[model samples]
Target: MTGIPKTYQRIVLAARPRGPVAPENFRLETLDVPELADGEVLIRNHYLSLDPYMRGRMSSAKSYASSQPLDQTMIGGTAGQVVASRNDYYRVGEFVGGMLGWADMGVSDGVLLRKLDTTRIPLSTYLGVVGMPGMAAWYGFNQILEAGAGDTVVVSAAAGAVGSVVGQLARLRGCRVVGIAGGPEKCEYVVKQLGFHACVDYKAGNLEADLAAATPDGVDAIFENVGGACLDASLARTNAFARVALCGLIAGFNGQEMPIKNSRLLLLNRVTLRGFIITEHMEFWQQGLQELAVLVANHQIKYRETVAEGLAAAPQAFMGLLQGHNFGKQLVKLI
Candidate 1:
């Protein structure tokens, strides 16, 4: 065994919640790190992204992949600086992206972790805009939704990590952007800050009307985020042959299972709905990243992160995200 001291610190999935995940679902545990094999590097985790999909992973049932087995370390996508390396590909000063889960430190084979240029983009960007969230926007808007200039594009969760980028990119493409967020401040940010043409607040108790007022010509494309009432309302207003990209359903994350309604209406509306995973669009990553970097560098786009200071506070931060309490991207700064 390579002489790397063993240590353990993990958020174990103690139990699956009956509804939205609860604090008890995770228990902090400490264990020894396995010795680093050749071609492996150890990272001292810096920032861990808290995404909506983590909600599904917490459930003990199958969704996209294997469920987080009970009593095991929870899974997450994290960015960290390399502290030790046995692989020439990853030096001690290099930053990396990997399945590091939620811990202060972790070891992985060079295959699972990719070196990142921290000088070009902040390490945090690897977990958001220049990373998975950016990837989600590239595929959802360009490939899945196929958004076009002058087309009316509506995106729910518009002020979030993914939706925010989608809205700005569609606007950059000369599309009319309409965004749906939870409250008035977020709505204002979407319209005034992100340059979206219109925005609505689903929490206003009149989402349907506000939504209608935002898209008088009807929506040509929609990037769905909160998928209960918002999805239903968007479907009702879709333009002929409109397209929809199903990204996430935070509405159902808390056990509010909304039945897919108006299934027959797709035949009438000629709407095309596609569900996508960001990993599927690995090919288009560079094209999107190059553009996104320019936007960020030029201040054409902005991002907000509701950062939680310690790894121990991650569960609370994650819960806030699922509950719409977070103002923007949710993250845990372990370093």
Candidate 2:
């Protein structure tokens, strides 16, 4: 609390994007910090998470979550330290995770924020492997796909936060895992470092052929992250009774239309496709968090991150994430 400041800088939604989001869509503002009332806690954010789902929140379209209001602090996940506190539960100098948005500092009433133990793992890990993205891969892989050993599993956007975990979990379950990433570097990292059985570079202009070659036995489980060509290619290679966990549609995030042309493949293959958001299944949170933390702790899972240096770089970093420019998890370091 000794070095805590009285004001902070934050980014707000200045305008909705007409197509792909740009830096002009956001505005930065400096403001006086609010005095903490009884039961309120002040947080000084250390890391801000950049995710693909955020693109949907920018548009005023029907989505599982409500649209982000204009001129408001842009919505985000943050890991930070409690700089000051009047709340009985949270203490000063303790780390916490919350939806504190794109702010250098924030105040909360101890509602959504959760205390974190930064002693064991890197504090930023809470924003990636041990956070929402990890929970997403956990639920999608275990609950939705119910993948079994010896199954041929395929995951798109395989180098990303959720996709990387999905591939690793599937491989750990004794499945032959194949990943689809954007470039040769990511593909190499996916197969060599992450231990996926194979990785296809979708940007190589051989998606259908490469995927077909990779999953020669046909895909038993598909974790669909990028929707357009990747989903289409996976659908074409599905075995009967295949399970498809539809995650993020990063391919069409810039307002491109996503239409399924392989209708016959689904009926012929008897595939099961389920789109899920981790927030909807609160019952699985405890189990998922425990398993994810354990895997991370034991080194059974590997993760990577592309860190943006500061809050001002968040907008551009996020834009890069949408284009598959990030090698792994995209994050903004605010400290």
Q: Best candidate, lDDT-wise?
A: 2
Best model number under TM-score: 2
TM-score per prediction, in order, is: 0.95, 0.98
lDDT, candidate 1, residue 235? 83
lDDT of each residue in 1-335, candidate 1, tens digit only: 34444785778788888987789888998888766788888888889888988888877665877787888767899999888888988888788988888888888887878777776668898788887887898789988888788899989999999999999889888999999998999999888888999888988899888889988998899899888888888887888899999988889987777976756657788999888877766789888887787777788778888899987898989889988887667889887
> Mind giving the per-residue lDDT tens digits that candidate 2 earns over 1-335?
56778779999999999998999999999998988899999999999999999999999999999999999999999999998999999999899999999999999999999888876778888889999999999999999999989999999999999999999999999999999998899999999999999999989999999999998899999998998889999999999999999988988888899988886898999999999988999899889988888898899999999999989999999999988889778999999
* Candidate 1 structure lDDT: 0.85
Off by over 4 Å in 2: none
The models' CA-based lDDT, in order, is 0.85, 0.92
Instruction: Give the Cα-based TM-score of candidate 2 against the true structure.
Output: 0.98
Show the colliding residue pairs in model 1: 7-33, 8-30, 8-31
